[model samples]
Target: MSLRTVARDDLKNAARSYVVLGVVGVFAALVALVFVSERNIYPDPYRTLFDVSFMTFLVFPLFVAPLSYLAVAGDRESGVVKYVLGLPNSRLSYVLGKFASRASVTLGAVVVALLVGFVVALATFENAPNLGRFATFAGVSALYGVSLTGLFVGVSAATRRRSRAMLGVFGAYFLLVPFWFGFLPIVNIGTVLDAVATTFGTTVTESTRSFVNALSPATAYLYATEPVYSGVTDQYPQLAGTFGGESSRIEAQLWFNVLTMAAWGALGLLAGYASFRRSELG
Candidate 1:
């Protein structure tokens, strides 16, 4: 079959995954509940929704990691990959096809979940998030999911063994990504910056430090999708507490956040493509 044809079939198969369905269901339910709570418990709807957006940081990894892991590693373990290759498919095509299929499913789930959040928020507060904010949230959220899918699938493609792939991807998700966050706080970034300044005669501001700290995908996604709810006090007099509050905001621009996510995906794809090309079947 042609590459596109093969990719289409893969998409269909990926869509059938029960894991994907479960994640989507959970995401939708959580979003709905958050909105439902906004109507009752949370007096400040904007702040409440802002807090709710942080859940995306958790959901991005939760959804993409398993889907990408099973896409290649499971097939390899079951010997399905050998059959797939025998059908005149290249390893590169297989990797790309899997990326397309799995990433689409990841993105689709996020969109549906966000849609539920939007509808319920409108119904509850009689006010919806700004149109621009919602669009950016949906688009960036989808891209964030895709980037993660590429990263995990690439890791999975690097090994034919399911166990190894699982270990590596899990390490990346749990340990590696969070490492930057933990390491930065302990290691004295100021000292590191001083060394850079001494050597290169350049100064770094706190804003620059904040930007650098956002290098991790987790931080980057959080920064990019942060809801900016201006004039919430004027619109909903009850939600004035949400106005002028400063928490959970990050210091990177939208472009930098996008680039950070894209870089993770690109690096993963390159790593997976290179390694998978030389990988031996069991």
Candidate 2:
């Protein structure tokens, strides 16, 4: 029917996800900070930043991803799909409402956590990251969150079986997201090299530089992680010895991740909306 009516319902459902994710994120962050501080092994700002951002971006998203599965399945389970489908609005509108409402909530929480994490990190760390780098890092993280949430929503919309949908969501996370996070670091050597090349008086090769620019997500993590933690790798060689420059230039790779994540997220939203519209809700 009307957007107002749809929004009201969407808001109610989204609250559940926010409450659950918020509690888990806060508790986990506190525990992690305490545990790391106890070790007293030379404070690593990059690690700390990773701990904080991972909790906010990766960990929390893991839990909230399940919400996408439940949204449509829950409606179907309750037998309300028939009535809702019969409303004056097109299914597209209804689906978009769900996506807009829930995604907004998830996106907001992530943005807040990252900002707060940066502030806390800066105050705590002796070496504060530059503001420009920090902004780029946050943008990349947001795109990642969007991609994570959007895909799950799409999968959920496409399935009638709740368990199947969640499994699909989580399965993709374990298999693909990690590969992107861990391995992509290798290719993202540009920024890391750029910083280090100055010392060597020899710049990384252009092809190798492009690989780093196209693949690495490390810089994204580095920028956000710097104030929060230490040991965040800013760069790496694209390959073992194929003329890929030193890792220092890899920090530049974060922008590639930012754009890629945004592209996936946009696709996910489109898929979710389309699937939701086609869904009979029967």
The best candidate in terms of lDDT: 1
Candidate 1 Cα deviation (angstroms), residue 57: 0.8
What tens digits encode model 1's per-residue C-alpha lDDT throughout 20-53? Answer: 7888888778877877876765544455556666
lDDT of 2 by residue, 172-243 (tens): 665444543444554423445766887889888876665544442322442323332112343322111222
Instruction: Tell me how candidate 2 scores on lDDT.
Output: 0.55
Instruction: Show pairs that collide, candidate 1.
Output: none
Count clashing residue pairs per candidate: 0, 28
Query: What does the lDDT read for residue 127 in candidate 2?
Result: 57
Regions of model 1 farther than 4 Å from truth: 41-46, 183-208, 226-251
Q: What is candidate 1's CA lDDT for residue 129?
A: 52
Give the per-residue Cα lDDT of candidate 2 at 190.
42
Best by TM-score: 1
* Candidate 2 to truth, TM: 0.63
lDDT score, residue 15, model 1?
66
